[model samples]
Target: MELIKLGERTFCADGPFKVGVYILKEADGYSEVCIIDTGVDEAAAREIDEALVKAGFRVSLILNTHYHADHSGGNRYFIEKYGCKAYSQKINAAMISNYDICPSVVWGGNPVKEVLNNYFYAPPCEAYDISELEMPEGLSIIEIPGHCIEMFAVKTADEVYFLGDGVVSVDTLKGHKLIYVYDIDKQLESLELMKGLKGKVFVPYHGGITEDISKLAEANISVMKENIELILDICTTPKCLDDIISEVFDRYGYKLTMYKYAVEGGVIRAYVTYLYNKGELVAVKEDNYIRWKKA
Candidate 1:
C-alpha cells in the first residue's frame, strides 16, 4: 500500500491515482480519517484500508470529492467495510441517489455493464448515510459547477485544495483528443476560480499534480478558445447538438468516440446555455428535448 506523508497528520495516496485521503491522528491513541476520493474499485479500498492501519487511524468517514466514477465508484464497498458514512455535494448526492450515468462510466460492451445497470435499477435510492461539510471540520466545500454540476473541492488545513475534476492539465487532456463538460463557460469560470485560489497545492482530478494552478488554468482557457474558434469557423448555419458534433468532429477526422460525442455536445450546449442565460439564445423546454436558437 502506497501511503504518502504530506505534512503532519495528512497522508495522500500518491501514485497510480492522485486521489488524496487525509488522516488526522489524535494523541490519545485515536485518529480521524477523511477520504477525499475513492479509486476504480476494490483494490483501492484494500490499499487504503492498509494505509489507515499503518497510520493507526480509524476510518471514521469517507467523503467523495465528486460523483465521477473514479471518485465515487467504491463508495458502497468502502462505506460498508469500514462502517463509515459517505458524503458528496447535494447535486452529487442526487446523482448517486438517482443513479445517474454522469457519475458512472458506461462504455458499451464493457464487462461491468450488467453490474452497473443492475446497480442503477437497485432498490430505493442508494443510501447517503454521511454527514455534510462544515468549516469547523477543517474542509471548506466550494461549489464549482461546470465539468460536472454540483462539483466541489476540499480545502484542508492551511489552504490545501482538492479540485475534483474542475480543472485539468492541458497536456493530459490533449491525449484523449478531447476533454469533457456540459458547459465550457461555466468550466472556464470554475477554472478562473482555481486561478484566484490562495492554496499552494492544486489537486486537479485528471492532472497528476499541480502547485502552479494559475498557469494550468490559463492554458485550459486558451485551449477552449482555440476549440471554440475552430468549431465556430465551421458552424455557419444553425445546427443542433448532434449535427454539430457529427460535423465538427467527423469532419476534422477525429475519432468520433463515445466520450468525444458527449464532449462535443457538451461544448456546444455550454455555449448555447450561456447564451440562453444571457438572453442571447432562446430555449424552449420540450418533453425530452430542449430547443435553443438565437433569441
Candidate 2:
C-alpha cells in the first residue's frame, strides 16, 4: 500500500481499509509516526511497516479507534516490533488485551471454532485507556461510538479527521445494504455529529477521503432508516428473530455463512432492539417462541 499525503503531517496508507499515519516528530534522525489504526492482520501491519520504513519513519504509538479485528488486528505486531504504546477507550482496551471477547460477544456465547479466525479474533495486545494516556501533540479524540463500543475519531493537527467507521461509503451501504452497528440510536447521533465536524479532510476507514462528509453522513443515515423500515415491514405479521434474520438475508441476497450469520445477524438484532424500544414493535411470547410484530 502507498502512503498518500493528506496534510503537512498526515498521511493515509490507502488499502482495502485505510490506515492513518501521522508524523508526530523527527527523533534520532527518523520520523516518529503515530498510527491511527492498524489494518486487518500481521500481513497488513507488515506492509504498513515496510511502507513507513521505506519512507524513513518508525512507529512509536498506535491509537486504536476500537477493538474490532479489522481495525486493531495488527496491534500486537506493531507493539512487539517497535515497542510502541497502544491506547484506546477503556472498554476497547480491555477487549484488545483479550480479543476472545469479540467473537464471543458476536456469537452471544462461547464462539465455535469456525468463527475464531483473525476476522473475529484479533491477536491480543496490551493497550492502555486513551483517557489516561497523554496524547501526542496535535492529536485529539472525538467520541463517535455506535459502529462499535467506545469508538473514537481522531482529529490531527492538520484538521484531518480519521473517522473510524463512523460513516461508510455509499458503495459500502449499497453492497451490504446494512452495516453492523452496536447501538442504532448512538449510530444516528454519530452520523449527525459527523456532519457538524470541521475538518480539511475526513477519512473513514471504509470510505475514501473527502473534504466534505455531509453527503456520506446523510447516505449512512438514510440506509439506517431504510433498514429499520424494512425490519418493521417484516414484523407486520409477527415473526421470530430467526425468521426476521432469514427474511432480511433473502431480501438483501446475503450468502449465509457462519461469519455473516453472526455479524449481519447482529445488525438486524440492533435494528429490532431500536424499533422495539421506540414502541414501533412489540414482543410476544407464543408457542414457546418470542416473536415481534408491528405495534
Candidate 3:
C-alpha cells in the first residue's frame, strides 16, 4: 500500500483498512515517527517501514486505536523490527497482548481455524496502557469508543485527528451495510461527540481525510438507526435473535460466511440491545425460546 501524504508530517497508507502513520520531525536530522493502527498483517507493517525509510524517518513509538486485527495486527513486526514501545488503552492493551481474546470475542466463542488466521488474530506484542504511558508533547488522545472497546483517536498537534474506525466512508457504508460495532448506543453518542470536535482535518481509518466530519458522522448514525428500525419492524412478533439476524442479513443481501455471520450477527445483537434499553422492544423466553418483540 502506498503512503498518501496528509500534511507536512502526517501520511496515510491505504490497505484493507487505511492505516495512519505520522512522522514527527525533531530538530535533529533523525526524525521520530509514530505508527497508528497497523494494517491487517506483517506485509502491511513492512509497507509502513518502507515508506518511513524512503522518507528518512525512524520509528520511535507505535499506537493502536483498538484491539481489532486490522488495526493492531502489525504490532509484532514493528515492535520486533524497531524495538519501539507500543501503547494502547488498558482493555485494548490486554487484548493485544493476549491476541486470542480478539477472535474469541468476535466469534463469541472458540473461533475456527480459518477465523483464527491473521485476518482476525495477530501475534502478541508487548504494549503499555495509555494511562500509564506519558503522552508525547503536542499529541492528545481522545476516548471514542463504539466501534470497538475503548477505541482512542489520536489528535496530532497539527489539528489532524487520526480517527480510528469511529467513522467510515460512505462507499463502505453502501457496500457493508452493517459496520462492525459493539455498542450502538455509545456509537451514536460518540458520533455526537465527534460532531462537536474541533479539528482542521479528520482522518478515518476506512475513509478519506476531510476538514469536516460532521456529515460523515451523521451518515453513520443514520445508517445505525435504519438498521435498528429494520429490527424493530421485524420484531412485531416475538422473534429469536438468530431469526432477527437472518432477516437483516437477507434484507442487506450480504453473504452468510463464518466471518460475516460473526461480525454481522454481533451488529444485529447490538441493535436489539439498543432497542431493549430504550424500551422500544422487550425480550422474553417463550416455549423455551429466547425472543425479542416490540414493546
User: lDDT per model, in order?
Assistant: 0.63, 0.89, 0.83
In candidate 2, which residue ranges exceed 4 Å CA deviation?
Answer: none
lDDT of 3 by residue, 23-131 (tens): 6657476678887887778888888778777767777788899888788888888888888888899999998889988888777788766578775688887788988
Q: Per-residue lDDT tens digits of candidate 1, residues 142-246?
A: 877777766788887846777877777777756543466666667888888878888767777565577788888788777777666655554444455566567
Q: What is candidate 1's TM-score against the reference?
A: 0.78
Ranking of models by TM-score:
2, 3, 1
Candidates 1 and 2 compared by TM-score, better number: 2
lDDT at position 42, candidate 3: 89
Best by TM-score: 2
lDDT for predicted candidate 2 compared with the true structure: 0.89
As for candidate 3, its clashing pairs are none
> In model 3, which runs have C-alpha deviations exceeding 4 angstroms?
25-28
Clashing residue pairs in all predictions, respectively, total 0, 0, 0
Candidate 2 clashing pairs, residues 3+ apart or interchain: none
